[model samples]
Structure formats: structure tokens, C-alpha cells
Target: MNPVLSSSEVGVKINEWYKMIRQFSVPDAEILKAEVEQEIQRMEEDEYLLIYFSLMKFRHQLMLDYLEPVTTRIRPTIDELLEKIETSNKGISGLLSYYSLFFRGMYEFDKKQYMKAIYYYREAEKQLIHVPDEIERAEFHFKLAEAYYGMKQSHVSMHHVKQALDIYNQYELYKVRKVQCMFVISGNYIDFKRYEKSQPHLEKALELSRELNNKRLISSALYNLGTNFADSGDYEQAEVFMKQAVEITEKEKLTNLPHSLFSYAKILFKQGKMNEAIQVSKKGLSAALYQGDELFAKLQGYLKALYVDAVDQHGVNQTIEYLEKNKNYSYVEDIACETAAAYANSKEFETSYVYHQKMVETQTQIQRGECLYDF
Candidate 1:
């Protein structure tokens, strides 16, 4: 338990604490944080280990917030810690500089500043030459993949994820990250409508998740499988998988509940269960709102489609107003197309033409990789 007596002991303790703090709950992280801080203080002579422990503490807080979706507010303690890291001598250790950049990138990523996150990630990658640990390098690549994925650059994301996976495959301790990489790769395939290719990855992820007894990963695998089945027009299979995902998330109060509910609602809408879809969408919308405005924006698009089908022009107009107010460009193109069709169905030719043109313009902008709306 005495971390200061030996350098090797400190390294082992750091890794142990890192794994413990990675649990998906605030209370669990709090316990590990206390233990880590005690050990770090005892080893105050080791500045390098001190910085590494500090970064782990910051990462623990970030992971807790991400998993719970309680608040977007960054704690002042984290900011203070960053300031200390910045003021410290950089030549003390390359890991000090590497982790500083890495944590900054993660902070930007949490704020949805994907481009800024990528910039910091690149800077951190440059410092990786000093890092001899392949596991740490793979971790950086995994984070870069997530940043690119958020930017909707699927090809770039896939490339980084593949690199991470290749590294992870060489280490047993990185099996969890390997499963995560598979999930990201499957997501990229899904984005391209390659459902057949996506399925095997999800299946593998599901098997691995089960073996690891990771409920969150299990739910994620099930949810993605549901999306694949739905996209491929297999409503029965989609419903079964999505329902299971929903149940697991709701039971565990997982952060993925809102997304799973939205997917389930979409499947219901596609099956013409309009009332059921509306009910589920409403629940999902409320959950998304609790999570954050960004999540709310994504969930609203599905609800918009449901309203257009079941309600009236007024319902569709309401959805349009909501999206416009929020300025979530991610769905503007889809909303415009839906609005055009809804108007066309009601014989409002003038309105239909206007929205159809709007849809076309949005599509063109999206195709050109331009920022058409303020998302």
C-alpha cells in the first residue's frame, strides 16, 4: 500500500487506480479519487508520478460526468489543476506535457468543440515520441478517432480506430479498448449503410462485452444491432434488440437510455404504431433534455418525423420552430425534406416547393462539407 517506497510500486499503483476510477459512476470514482490522492501525496517527491496522478483524477471526473450526464459544468478544481500543470517545468517529464495536452483535448471534446479537440490531439500526438508505452499511444489514437467521429469524418475516424485496435490486439489489458474500437468501426460502416459489414462487429462486441460483464457495453452493442436491423428493414429483429437495450439502460440508469429510446421510437414509427411512437419519443425527448441541449437536438428530429406523420401541419411547424430556435444543423437537411413532403401530401404546392428548394440547398451544402447551419 506504500506507493513512495519504490518507483515500480508507484507505477503499479497508478495503473490499478486508473482502472478502478474508470468505473461508470460518480460514487465509485469518488472512492478511487480519495485513495489515489492519498498515495500521490505520499509520493510527493516523484513529480512525474504526481502529474500523472493529477491527470488521472481529472479524467476520473470527466468520465463520471460523461456517464451520468448530470451537468456540463467543468469543475474549478480541474481548471486549477491544469494551471498547476502549465506552470510546472515541462522538461521534468514528457508524460507531463503529453497528459496536459491530452486532458485539454478531452475537455474541448466534452464541450463538442471537435475541431479544437483534434488540434490538441495532434499536439499531444507529437509528444508521443517520448512515450514508449504502446498502450498509451493506442489510447491517444482511440481519442483521436472519437474526435473525428464527432466531426462526422468517418473515414478518418476509422483509420485511427484501426490503429488503436492493432495496438490493443497485442495487449490483454487493452481488451476493453479493443471492443470499443470495434464498436466505432461498426458505427462507421453503419454510417455508410453497410449494415452487413457492421453486423459482425456488433456481434463480436456483444460477445466481448458479455465476457467482460460490462452492462453498458452490452447495451451499446444491442442498440447498434437494433439500428442495423431497422436500417435493413427487419422490423421484427430491430424491435426485439432495441427493446432489450431499452430495458437494460432504464434498469441501470445508463447514459445511453435516451438514444436507445429514440431508436426504438423510430422503429415504432416505421411500423405505423404512431401512438406508441409518440409516447416513446416524448419520454426520449425529456431524457435528452435532461442530458443536454445537444442530445435534445438529435432526439427532436425523430419526434419531428413522428409528428409529421401522425399529427398535422401545425405539429410539423412546431418541430420546425424548435429546430430553428436550437440551431441544430445536423438535422436541418432532413427536416427540410420532411417538411416539403408533408406539405406536398396536403396539396400546399407553394409551401412544398419552397421547402423542397431549401432541402436541396441544405443537401448541397452538406455534400460539400460546408457548415450550412449553426450547430
Candidate 2:
């Protein structure tokens, strides 16, 4: 077959590639990428089309990393590409500019830099007027919701989720995206302590995930269900759901395996299963270390310190420092509150008061910071 084609023909193929990425169809995307590149080779002129192709290529890499996380230490090729794009551009189209900012947000989101992700997403929203596709707008809202959720800004997350879900519900081809939006809604409900409300969304998501035959979505639904149960004081049911979630992710070698393991270990700890929790934590920590996931490693280490090993103010303070340094004020507040309760249970009123004060301070900090982005 001839590899060379008119620019319009190559553009159609690139469009198909973007659709594959949206659907998370890695195999099809990989094949389409090769075909698109072949068509692009030895072609000159049409710089606008080439810029669009380059942006799509960047998005392809983001999709790949999202589906299966990069295990080894890799260079920041996306960063380099974005820098090149910005530097060489004399006048790029509004659509290309929007994609550049949006994909940059995705890259930051993947790195767990939620604040930076939200900043870029907000910037991209300014250019959203140029994007006429409602589905693409839904995608943007969904991604913004995810960034908000990562920062524990459930209210802001819900605002975006509602917008995305409303648009996604109108399209039959967006069932996968609909499932993801439901997951975010359920997550926000969980954060709000509306476990009953959370369950139905997750159940619907699970049903949709099974109907779609998407293992990743299925595992996520199961995990969220587990969290709902655990938060509602149903440890046994939580364990059952979480165990299934962990098993499914592990069997599939999914990108969320480390997270599942860490959450499962936390559930075990809650059940007063010290030995089992410690063992699970060790397994998760090893996987996190192997994946170079510093966040999980620190989280699991804190779990071990608080439960597996003897609990002390020093260990708690160290973890609090780490979270504070990372700007994870949500976690800082949570850990501080838990530590305050623990000290209270032990009849250490002074120590409890100290942690209680710390928790209050952290909460104030979080609320003040999030106020800037309030919708």
C-alpha cells in the first residue's frame, strides 16, 4: 500500500487515532499511530495540519501512560515537545492552543500535581469557545472534575461532574465516559459521607463496566464500593469488595494495582488485623517502590508507622511534615484528626489538643486555598 497521502487523508486518520485514544483502545491507537506517521513522513507544507498531528501524538503518549503507567524513570519528552511547540509557534489555531493547555493539564494530573493541573485546565477553559464539539467539551469537564477530586475539592469536582455527565448521557458512544463520570460522582458522594447515595452510582457504574467489558472500570467501581462500605462502618463488606478489586487489578496488572493494595491495607488496619495489614502494606510498598510511586510509598509507610509499628508522635509528625511539604493539606488534616482521636482514646488530653489544633489549622489552610477556585 502507498504510504504517502494527501494532507486531508492523513488528517482523517489522525482523527481516528484521537477517537481510539478517547475510547482507551490502545491496540487500535498504536496501529493508527504508525499509519498516521507513515503518511506524515516525506510530506512538507500544511504546517497547521502538522501541528495538529504533533498535538495528537502528544495526547497518544498521555493515553498510553494513563492505561499502563510507566514503570521506569523516563525523560520528560512531553515537556520537551510542549516547550518546542510553544517556542516555534508564530500563530497556532485556537484549537491547537486549547489542546496544548489541556494536554499539559493531563500530564500534570498524571504526575499528581493537582493544583497545576487545575490551573492549566482553567486556562484551557478560556479557549473552549473555539471548540464546538460538545463531546470534547464534556471530556474537558470530566478531566477538570478529576483534578478537583484529586485535591479533595469534592464540591468543585461535583460541579464539573454534573456538566460532563449531562453531556455524556446524551451520547450512546460515550458510555465509557459516562461510567467515569459516575465514578467521580460516587467519589464525591463518598467524600460527603453520603454512602447510601454513593452506592447506587457505583452499582450503576459496575453494571455499565461489565456491560462494556472494561476491566479497569470494573475494578474502580469495586474499589469505590469498598470505600463506601468502609466509611459507613461495614468492615466485612468493605473487605469483600476491596479484596475483589485488588484481585482483579493484580490479575490484570492494571495501573491502579498499587493504589488498590494501599487502600486494602488501610481497610485491614481499620479491622484491627495488624499482622495482615502489615503484610499487605509490605506488598503494596514493594510494588510502589518498583513503580517509583513515591506518594504510595510514603502513604504506606505512614500506615505502617501508625498501626504496624508502635504509634508515636514522632512517626505521626514525620508523616504530617511530608504531606505538608508536598502541599497535600487534605491528607495533613485527615491524619491530624485521626491522630488527635487516637491520643484522646489513650487519655492523653494535652497531646490530643495539640493534634486537634493542627487539624483545625490544616483545614483552614485547605479551605482558604480552595476558595480561589470556588465556582
Candidate 3:
């Protein structure tokens, strides 16, 4: 508590904090309190050291990142930790450096800057050189793999996921780690366009999630399975899985439920269930946009494509208004183009022509890497 503690005494205190932090639990709350309390003591005596402790707390919080996004304040704390990496108390130097690197890497992940996140995550892995906890090491490696996957580096992602799997298996954290890797791997398979290959992974993940009563993973696996089926035009199977995902996600208040709803709506749209598809698409688009994810393009396109079915069911006037409003949405130009053609077919030639012009303009701008929106 002294304002001007001797170097030797500070060294001893740092060692104590280091020991507690080094043994910090993964996805467990109790060990975090012990670590952060000692960290707070260090901060009380040394204002600058507070930077590193705060960053560590951020990382700890990320274990529950499935619940909340990382805070904006985490960014500058990382800046200070990296700035003071050198010429610090030797006892905490290595530990602080490790955290600085870990938090900085995660900051990139939070920003959706995937490649930069991978760079920082790799640096954190190297800094884990002296971290004795095998479970913690596994978690670091697992997160590195996730960053790589986000960057679409599939092979490297698999390698790190497997490494984490090994450690988790050794420490009997297999259920938790397995669900994480399996969900991503299932997604990777979808990325590769191997629908059949992806099913087993998703099914297994879902089964495990159910077995363990992990609603989040259960929802995730179901959603992935639904999407794969929908993308492959298996609407019947897709509907089943997607509804399951929606049920769980809504029950659990999962933020990504909109993504699931979008998938289901797309399949319904294709199946000519115009009313049902429109209802779901509107709800899904609302949630996706709320999270700042760009899903409107596809959702709007789905509604527009339903022009034919909408005319037969919901009426041409309503479909025309919807298409005109979202005529230039990105990401699904083909769908938008089809929508215009549908409008033209419905005898709304002038409105259809406007949609055609808008899609062309947006496509041209996108190809040139120019901003397409007025706002």
C-alpha cells in the first residue's frame, strides 16, 4: 500500500501477483477474482501497472464474450501495456507482455480485422512460453485458431484447433473444447461447399451439445446444419434444423438468432412460401442489422424475389414497393436482378426498370471498390 515502496518489496509483490495470474482459470470465475484482486493491489501502488491488469481483466471477460462484445476502453489499455512492456518491474514483465499481446490481438478480432487479429494472436501464443497452465495454453491456441478461421485460413485453423483439442482432452475439458472446434469446422465445411461432409460434424456437435445441455452450442450447431441444407436447396431439411435453431436461440436470447432466421426465410422463399418467408425475413433482418452485420441485402433480395409468389398471395403492389425500396442492396445481385425481372413480368415495367438500373449502378460501383450508398 506504500506510495514509495522499495524495489525489492515491489518485486516480491509482483511475484505474488504473477503466480496468481499465471494460474488463472479458463472459463472459470473463481480464479479470476484472486488474480484481479492482487492486480488491483499492484495498481493502487503503481498507476502505470494498472494498464496491464485492466487488459488482463478484459481477456478474462472474453471467456464470456459469447455474452458481450469487448469494451472500447480495452483498446487504449492495450496501448499502454505494450508501451510499458520494457523497463517495467522484472517480476511482472513477462506476464504483462503476454497479456498485452493477447489483448491487442483480441482487439483486432473485435474490430473484425481478421488478419491483424491472427498476427496478434500468434504473438500471444509465443508469449505463452512460460505459462504453466495447460488448460490456459489450450485456450490461447484455440483462440488463435478461431482468428485464423475468420481470415479463411482453413488448414492453419484446423491445426490450431486440433492442438487445443489435445490439451483440452488431456485436462478433461473435452466437451467444452470439442463443441467449439466442431461448430467452426462444420462451418468450414460449408465454406468449402461440401454439404454432405459437413452434416456429420454438425450432427455430432449438436448431439454433444444436447447431451451436455449446452443451449448455445446446440443452437449454433442446429443453425449451421440448417444453413448448409438451405444453401444446397434442401429446404425441407433446412426448415427443420433452422426452426430448431430459432427455438433455442430465442429461448436463450442468443444475439445470432437472426442469422438463423435469415437462413430459414431464404429456404421458405425458395419454396414459394411467400407469406411465411416475408414474415421471417423482416424479423431476421431487423436483428442482423441491429448487430451491425450486413444481412439486409440478402433478406431484401429474398422479399423481392418473392414478387411472383407475393403477387399470387400478398399482391403485386406490396411486392413492388418492397423491391423499389431495396433495389440496390449488395451481396445478392443475382437475386436483385431476378426481382427486377419479376416486377417487369408483373407488368410494372417502369418500376421494374428502375430496379434494373439501380442494381447495375450498384454492381458497377462494387466492382470498382467504390462506396455504393449515399449515406
Among residues 3 or more apart in sequence or in different chains, the pairs in candidate 1 whose N, CA or C atoms overlap within 3 Å are none
Residue pairs in candidate 2 whose N, alpha carbon or C atoms collide under 3 angstroms: none
Give candidate 2 misplaced runs (Cα > 4 Å): 1-4, 69-76, 90-93
Off by over 4 Å in 3: 1-49, 67-93, 125-132, 292-375
Candidate 1: segments with Cα more than 4 A from true spot = 1-12, 19-35, 45-49, 63-80, 83-93, 292-294, 301-375
Predicted candidate 1 versus true structure: per-residue lDDT over 1-375, tens digit per residue: 644555556667777666654324456557757766665566547666766777887887777655443444455455677777767754644666777888889888776666678888888877898878777778888999987766556788898999988988886765567778888888888768899999999999999989978777888889989988987889989999999998888877776667788889878876878788878888888877876646454545546654634434555556656554443333555567766876787798898898788778755654444431233
Angstrom error of the Cα, residue 172, model 3: value is 1.5
lDDT of 3 at 253: 67
Question: What's the TM-score of every candidate structure?
Answer: 0.77, 0.92, 0.64
Clashes per candidate (backbone, < 3 Å):
0, 0, 0
Candidate that would win on TM-score = 2
Residue 176's C-alpha lDDT in candidate 2?
Answer: 83
Candidate 3 TM-score, C-alpha based: 0.64
Q: Which of 1 and 3 is ahead in lDDT? A: 1
CA-lDDT, candidates in order: 0.73, 0.84, 0.63
After the best TM-score superposition of candidate 3, give how far the Cα of residue 222 lies from its true spot, in angstroms.
0.9
How far is 147's C-alpha from truth in model 2 (Å)? Answer: 1.1
